[model samples]
Target: MSDSSALTQKLQQQVLELPPESLPDLEKFIEFLRFKFQPRKPKATAKPALDATHAVRLGGLLQGYDFSPELLKEARREMWRKFYVEAE
Candidate 1:
């Protein structure tokens, strides 16, 4: 027989030698192998349309607050100050 057939026969013999109680676990392993190696279908790339009714209103909460780039920069610097500390 060919090498592939010989290997297949050897695997079959080993599987046959396994106890009946271990069959369920062997079946689960075979299923896992099949699922792991199975070819997968490509997912749809199209996104669903957004509903205008559910759309968020920007700057609605902070309408009365004065927002500035400098304030944001200072807040970020203060928040991340601990991460930039140098070791003595």
Candidate 2:
């Protein structure tokens, strides 16, 4: 008999002795094996702590701008990027 045929026969005998309910999840295992692996996410850099002085400066800067709802949110986001965004 061919090597592959003999191997298949041995594998079939092994499977026949296994409990029907306890078989490994072959599909899920194959899917796991087939998955394209990705690298782990990098840890974010530490943020600078906010202080009373910075708050006062921000308040002073924002007090003069036109503070419409959308503009307010955009300004807040810009301020965060300006003051808190990590330098790569």
Candidate 3:
């Protein structure tokens, strides 16, 4: 017999000699070996499409906001003051 087949037979004989109480642990180890050796499937690359519901919710959220440059500058300065000043 081939070396691999001989080794497999020897392992099988040893497993058969093991007590019944140890059989469950042996089964778990065999399962772990199978899982470890199995090839992994590739993950999907395509992103899920965004629906109209998200767009409507976002529009509602920003409906009353001013997006002017001056407003953004004031918001940034306020954030800097709140975090940086307090950190010191």
Candidate 3 lDDT over residue span 1-88, tens digit each? 9999999999999999999999999999999999999998866896667887555444586687798999999999999999998999
Question: Which candidate achieves the best TM-score against the true structure?
Answer: 1
Considering only N, C-alpha and C atoms within 3 Å, which residue pairs clash in candidate 1? none
Candidate 1 vs 2: which has more TM-score:
1
Q: How does candidate 2 fare on TM-score?
A: 0.30
Off by over 4 Å in 3: 45-88
Clash pairs for candidate 3: none
Across 48-73, the per-residue lDDT of candidate 1 in tens digits comes to 67799778878688687766999988
RMSD of each: 5.7, 17.1, 6.8
Q: Could you tell me which residue pairs clash in candidate 2? A: none
Tens-digit per-residue lDDT, 22-87, candidate 2: 576654665677674656566688666788756744457657668799998998899889877676
| Segments of candidate 2 deviating more than 4 angstroms | 24-27, 30-88
- TM-score of decoy 3: 0.49
Cα error, residue 54 of model 1, in Å, equals 21
